[model samples]
Target chain A: MASPLPQLQPEVAEKFRSTVIPCRIEMPRLGLTFDLRTLTLAEALELMKIPDFTYLVPRPKRRKAASSSTSK
Target chain B: MNTFSLTHLKGPQGDDNTPGLLGYVLVAREDAFSKIAKAPKTGTTAGETAIITDNHTFTNADDGFAKVYLTLDSNMLKAAITGERDGRGLKISFEGFHPGNNAEALEFMRIVKNLGLIILVPDADGTYLQVGAEGLPVEFAPDYDSGKLSSGRRGFTVKGEAYANGMYIYAGTVKYKA
Candidate 1:
């Protein structure tokens, strides 16, 4: 059965899944390895389970800080 | 001198209690991650490293035009983006939203939080502000009188709604220039 939800673009979906929420991150040159709790873009979208929710790829803007935070 | 700008409008059911906000962030031309790594770890509470931002829209449900402008440095943005350094090069800007009517400024911040984003606030001495609740330094400018001093961005300003959004909001002209 085909699901009814609109699907994300393959590239967009892949990037979101990888960069947005990384389960494992390893920067070999920097000798960096950190376990990430961040959600892949897909996961974040998945968490936002709503019929009207839309994902927008923002136009390139200024580079923001490296980390992401959430506060309610 | 540089400029950044944004606009806020309400969606359907535009309500004054629901102001909309759209924001953007930019680092100085020569900024680097190393600088961030060495940046003072002074103004942070809750071990915050990443920042949150939002795009807000509010409507009065009556007027096509109400209060408008991108808001970031306002009370909300300040609370979301936090840091410790005094002189950083990163800048943020706001873009307009829809509905363009009745909305409260703080409500927009709540929207961002609900969406899982944070804002940064600046402190006195023209440095980033921090929240007492968490003790984190923010990256946006402090709130103040609009008429007393212009934010430099001249889009559409509604009276009785005087509040500084942030450096980007104030720098209306420099938004595209930067």
Candidate 2:
């Protein structure tokens, strides 16, 4: 029987699980640390509206092009 | 958690009294910290390197009570109460012919000179709300309102930059007596 849901690789599943863990934000200048719970997809969408919060996210790296020398 | 009600809105004296804002200007940063530190041991010599320790002791004498003045402006008061004013930008105006002519002027000059910190406490007895900011760099704009004679009060504005992440609020409450 065909599975109803698409299969996910183990690495992908591990990444998804790690995203659900809570994190701590440290402000050394203020000498304060705030514990932040994992955000739901909806909460992340809401946070995207904030400029400062959006700046914290890193951009994805670009893929390298294949070279003719590797074709051997 | 402290709860507020209409009944609790009464003045510190339990009447419809209007409380003024009391400003406490802290000394220069290092001096202020040193003042706040506890006194060294009685037998410790001033020049002894052993007397200098990383541990600090705080005492009541370290209270940084610099000056008390009445802040009469309603708009400023509202801004202080709501914390809506920008912590990075603060402007204080004073009416005087010259700087340092009055107590307020002197305090303003001192703040500008010292890169002083400020704590604003409501001048009402039993009120426990305090708003503070540290490491403020102040600039003086003398004769900011030289042409304004209609209001009868002329003054200059002292602009300052409040330190980022330096603003803090403290709220205290009294227990209800049975």
Candidate 3:
């Protein structure tokens, strides 16, 4: 608990209080690394259980030219 | 009579707590790293760097960071904190002005517009005033203005804002190599 009356040293009380507060900012010194190996390992194992050609996904033919056929 | 204690918030008398930052700044893109596998090490209690090695995964092969230099002007570059932690995170706003209006100046302005950025501001001392935490970053750009005849000055101010944590201090130079 703070005192009823705050008292400061004579020198301190004499000086002007110009922007005297300290820095309140603090960084949370921590970063994250994703474990893709562990996450995809389960999926990889699950893939091994499936037949080689269980489902064939049909994709559109690779377009040689972009939608626009204008000059390069 | 008695006195109250203002522990970490205030320092002892005669300590230098001066305000304002230097004119030069270091900036990098957010995606410049695959991921910061480790947080950058700050040397001081207030989070500054020391002579020790840095810890991080700065994965950018080409664009590590660009040092944007500004003329020696009072308060040329600055960073400010906003918002509170009542379930809402903080925000940071930075504005750096360079005195010029030529095409050379505008060339840099064109690139930073509306892109996520990482800013590192140096103080008069060996510390840095930084914004945008590791994973979270800021969006920055510039605004050009040619001053009036009375106090005419032609220049551009790089301004940006983001919902960030708060400002930080780095004791020494920043390491860009992963």
Candidate 4:
């Protein structure tokens, strides 16, 4: 997946750190549903200010869809 | 039925202009309150605890939820104000990932998106409701590797303007059905 930052305006990019990001991720294999709309460690710290947000630790990747469905 | 009237209070004085709060702290406001006289109604065994009211059902989406009622009584108002007595606070919860495991770069954006929940705290004196300001508690745990053991799930203890001074959290057994 490509970085969505390119889709945001410069001002929005700057404010992105403060505003809440919205999304809901589902991992069927684990029967887990993570509500990304809520705050996270990276959002709390505003990692966007950092040149490389990766300076922060990485979390497990979302397991890919088994059947390749657009909507989970 | 944790309900309270809206009362406006004076904000802290300073350049910040934001209601003067020291910081976000998770004060277990519920603990301080007197336990309900009646035995808390433990709902059926479900993954999440919930309160089903005539109008709505507040369910703890992830963790166990509790139904605490905040009334307009003097004591309840006192508890809300005390939440802010110490400072501002918020509740944070997190999970996933093994610490220091050089895997693919974790999208900070994704984490920020996933691990966040907003809390709405009503003000004393029945004026307005404050949400997404004070710190409550954060529960998180990173993946454990070969007993490497990562720690993230931790609750915060805070009191002040952010939590205790004018905040009342729900208490007692979470009701599943109204």
Candidate 5:
């Protein structure tokens, strides 16, 4: 990317690395979701420490399309 | 579902200013992970072993994150979680830029666009989340822009796959192996 910084009007202090990177993850396993900036290897490991933090992807529901459409 | 209230804050717990993203993003092959790291629906101590990375153990010190350089202190980085848009999986996206377009970087970015991946995104507040961690894989949309002209801007925009769901990553122990 162009190294020349965008001509942005300085808003926050230079010391503050304020980058609006929003991330919200849902833990259906625990019926919970939270907002964050990002997830890292270390952070993933940190979540493991929360006891039973299982992140499993359930198979997609193969609903019968024709039947469902008819019902609708 | 309507349990909490979004009342206006006016007391001591009103000062809410959080930092944005910082540091590097972590990406790995999807197959490298498995049905491990079983945390309970409710518990204090972790029952069994957590997710293992290529059979290697991760420690707390250097941690398991691959710290890389970021542009604008990772300001350009973004991880948008929009839940599952399609029946297949969670449709999501992530995009950012790396400073250089060297040969090594070029080749790596080229190949990674096809790799099934789960990316770990970190935040400046010390929290994190994993994209495509919910039983699906993500690929990258690498776009290389060369600012050849005086007004042109050079950049390599890496937009991760908008498939699979991301999970709330808590503070836990991680072990990554090459």
Candidate 6:
């Protein structure tokens, strides 16, 4: 049987696996797409400050307690 | 080894007298030449002009050319060199100048807002580089010294990116007898 994937040297495979993947972001509203490199720690942190998806979380709602104390 | 000097700079479609390093930096809108055609051939006849097919042209705003710098964004080429992609990115900077009239500033601002393609020609002798996509004018400051000196020099900074489908850089060489 033949392998489906091409055989790569160990070092070559390691180099390949270690490379950072680029990021592509699309903004349909603006009709724009950006091809960007992986973000550095600093850049990621800066992005964290923005209220994007990473920062958005649904807040839990509080329910009123029932007035059951009258039965006691 | 071969060497060359930075003698003068020119604007897109500008005539020979279009001011160079000492005078003004020009930003004109252009189409993505890469999608339209291959890179222009280097070393053509002295008087011949390279005709670009399906080219898009726009008005330009001229600013004083204090200094200009260009560099290859090699990181963008990693995938392309490995035959995984087709293009890379180039970074260019246009710095220093007296803020021209409001119209010129507005024109440049419009280019930034619209993300228009531009060509940054760094030599008067027909050597130039085209930047595809929007040339982002990241930083701009006017009247740096508050017009303190009689010369009245203002400063501005613009950073540009080239699309992968277009040529990233076009380098040309000129020889002179020392």
Model 5 lDDT, residue B86, Cα: 65
- The ten-residue window of minimal lDDT in model 6 chain B covers B70-79
> Which parts of model 5 have CA positions greater than 4 angstroms off?
A1-72, B1-19, B34-68, B73-90, B164-166, B175-178
Worst 10-residue lDDT window, candidate 4 chain B: B47-56
lDDT of 6 by residue, B57-174 (tens): 2222111112222222111111122223454343334444445335655565544545454443434433343334343322222222334466653333333443343333333211
Candidate No. with top TM-score: 3
Docking quality of model 4: it rates as incorrect
What are the candidates' individual DockQ scores? 0.03, 0.01, 0.01, 0.01, 0.02, 0.01
Task: Residues B44-160, candidate 4: write the lDDT tens digits.
Answer: 333112221111112222222222222222111112222254664433221222223233223322242333222223234222222222233222222223332474422211111
| lDDT tens readout by residue for model 3, B121-177 | 766653565566556777776877899988867888777776654445543224332
lDDT measured at residue B53 in model 2 versus the true structure, 0 to 100: 22
- What is candidate 2's lDDT per residue for A1-72, written digit by digit as tens? 753432223333332332212343322222333323333444444444644341124335555776775787
Q: Rank the models by TM-score, top first.
A: 3, 5, 2, 6, 1, 4
Interface RMSD of each: 17.4, 18.8, 14.9, 16.0, 10.5, 20.9
Docking class of 2: incorrect
lDDT of 4 by residue, A1-72 (tens): 755521223333333432112333222222333333343544425543544222123334567776867657
lDDT of 5 by residue, A3-67 (tens): 44222122212112212222334443344444323443344445546554433112345556687
Could you give candidate 2's per-residue lDDT for residues B1-178 as a string of tens digits?
1121122233457565555533422122323432222212332333222122222111222222233332244212223222355634333322213322466765566555444443323333323222322233222233344445565444443433233222222321111101
Displacement of the residue A65 alpha carbon in candidate 1, Å = 44
| Per-candidate RMSD, Å | 21.1, 23.8, 23.7, 22.0, 21.1, 22.9
TM-score of each: 0.19, 0.30, 0.53, 0.17, 0.49, 0.29
Chain B TM-score by candidate, in order shown: 0.19, 0.36, 0.69, 0.19, 0.63, 0.36
Worst 10 residues of 3 chain B by lDDT: B47-56
